[model samples]
Target: MCSCILLAALKNADEMLKDIISAVDTSGDGKIQYEEFRVFVEAAERQLLQLFRSIDRDKDGRLNKEELQAAFRRAGLSVPKRRLSGFFDEIDLNHDGFITFDEWRDFLLFMPTNHNGSPLEAAFSFYSSIVTVNPEGDSLVSDETLEGLGYFLAGAVSGGVSRTATAPLDRLKVYLLVNTKTSSNVAIAAAKQGRPLVALRNAGGPIVDAIVSLWKAGGLRTFFAGKLLLGWSRVLSGTDSHAGNGLNVVKIMPESAIRFGSYEASKRFLAAYEGHNDPTQISTVSKFIAGGIGGMTAQFCVYPIDTLKFRLQCETVKGGPQGNALLLRTARKMWADGGLRAAYRGLGLGLVGMFPYSAIDIGTFELLKKSYTRAVARYYGIHEDDAQLSNVATAVLGATSGALGATIVYPLNVLRTRLQTQGTAMHPPTYTGIVDVATRTVRNEGVRGLYKGLTPNLLKVAPALSITWVCYENMKSLLKL
Candidate 1:
């Protein structure tokens, strides 16, 4: 129960002293008794260890004020450079300036963050509350609920990243999909005169290039276009299948017991259909459940972005300096001609696309990882005792499995793109109907035409999918749930 051990895990010297005092002074006597203080010291040591690993800078077992500032910076705070001079002054309720373990504990226990402060601080407070509630397994509830918490965190983090990086590409994609009809009208006069279309507008580049070019022509703002939503879509669909598949391999799969006010009836049906904890009874069907649920959830939530994308692409490009008005014009046009239903042109195709894309990608990835993990463990003679080594191996195997799965599901990517791009275009898809769309693609482009972008799709998705599984497995082990 030495003071050093209790505070050793905290590199931030300010919080350390406060934590010590909070732990020791539990009695209402406003003083520390020898027996009670000793017990408090022991509890603080365990907690400090967890917090240190959670935020320690260099594994050196000590922290200074500068290191604490670095941790805040890593968490994306924009504190001023000189704030460390009295960093703990406000947080240290005991006026010690340097917090012992007890004072740190007391400050954390009653840090009133909700009704005031910057948005960033509020978000941090919310995130901290969640981690506190579900530190390990969220065993305060069932494993399924804990898994749900994992999904929430995964989506928030991954979705945010995805939205930022891919927004431009998605905007470009939508732009191209909508502009061909407008172009067809422009080229009407050229066609009559037997003249070639302008060089840049020739539509002869790689098809994706065409999509991007049209987006630039239309000049839409980045606006997250569809990137943010699409990223979460990836994680949600990935988490649903990947997590469940991994859980299934366990001796006993976890069932979700938490339910909201009216979801209980539906949950019962879901449980009934899923056979209620009978892992042996689950087959390929179970894998699709998560993909469908995740995709549908993500897609519906961001349908407006999808609509804006289409509007940006499809508006007629009237000549003169006013073409930028395409947005207002498209909105007005859609409003005058069609309502909400107009924005949902490809809704049917989305549902159809979700199942195969999610199922093929996630199911295949998890299955491959499962096989690879077993083979490696068998060949290398891995044992339960080698926990750390086994975990590293699992991540590697999961990544490999993801690559293989992406390759297997390559065709689905083409189908998904076609479903999104075709039919709903400024004009209908090339076919008179869905059957015609299929036949014409095969007839003109050959059978491989249906999978025009297969290679590129695999290249894009393989690492992404692999990383998703690797992340999920690593997180599971880290949580030790």
Candidate 2:
């Protein structure tokens, strides 16, 4: 028959392919049936068993930790000791501290096989390729490295976009924070200038006055004055630009990366110490502590740049420095004034506020997300693990959490900004220390003074946090974290 001729030609085309097909076609009828396929799978499993026995060097019929490590080495794979231990523990399903032949066979068989190699070879090759060393004998691919990269890229993109989008609000906040002039005074001044519309805009409130003033100084461009340069500088040089617009991706990237990376790392460390294999199973208090630690670490590393950015933002009110050399000039001046101390002026207060703020922000978001997932699962009659929150829900949760954090820390932020701006050419040294700043602010403007610019701050922070969380989660998913 024609079919018989075609089958014969197919079998003759490649010897290796014909052998594979024939191995699975145990019926020897040049066609594979269910019974024949089942027999082939049994044969493959038996071969896996043979491979396992070959690696059981002591002939104890079980693989101890040492033997398992030796097998990987013989396969020309180098794994971290910690990772190997985890692997070993996972395979020792009964917690017996050793892998029996049955366990080994089950693990090997679960791995997807490749046509080019046996199941055992495919599994080993896949594991080996997961973590690799470059020509310089340094680790080039690993879980930690990949996770950090994911955070870094996500942070950079989210920070840049969010900051750019909320730049006007940010500028308004900084302006209101630094300038103590009341809205009434601004309105009266504009009225005297015979600009009725300007006076009306100023009369709307401090937020309106700040917006109008910024607009008059440089039109609409003033809102995003320093952001463009910051973006360009990030692309051209790896260094951050002291742009007051808060769009410095180079600056934000490292801080965001460290914050998220350290948070995950801290959670893992705590989970291990608490005898939990999964970090997500850790307690809420533990999550809060981990988030606080991560926030502190990130704040410490970027505090100086933050101080510089605040100072630069304040400068926009007076139209101080401009162009590429602005950051260097500012740094040099700060160093000349008080050396390293000047650069870290409000760091103490910053840390104090950051701890609780970060703790609540991250912890609340996690708690909400967990509850949301559970509720969704319950409603749909599905497993909790199978439920996922929509992107809009994620953004809303992030915004709510961020707003709460920002509100709690707004007073400290105000004090820090005041302290950083003090002793500059415009605002003379009015406070001697943190206490002095707090005392003067409360003494002069009452309790509400501590919350100066809270409105614009909320406006800026809510969207920024929402955008940040959405982008970060999406990026993590993209990178398969």
Q: For this target, which candidate reaches the highest lDDT against the unseen true structure?
A: 2
Report RMSD (Å) for each prediction in the order shown: 16.4, 14.0
Clashing pairs in 2: none
For candidate 1, write residues 35-136 as lDDT tens digits. 886676456446544554444466655444555555555555543333333344433445644444454444343232232644335433432333332323
Q: What C-alpha lDDT do the candidate models reach, one value each?
A: 0.42, 0.71
Candidate 2 residue-wise lDDT, 193-234, digit = tens: 998888897665777667788776666656765454355554
TM-score of 2: 0.68
lDDT of 2 at 349: 96
Q: How well does model 1 score by local distance difference test?
A: 0.42
Residue 319 shift from truth in candidate 2, angstroms: 5.9
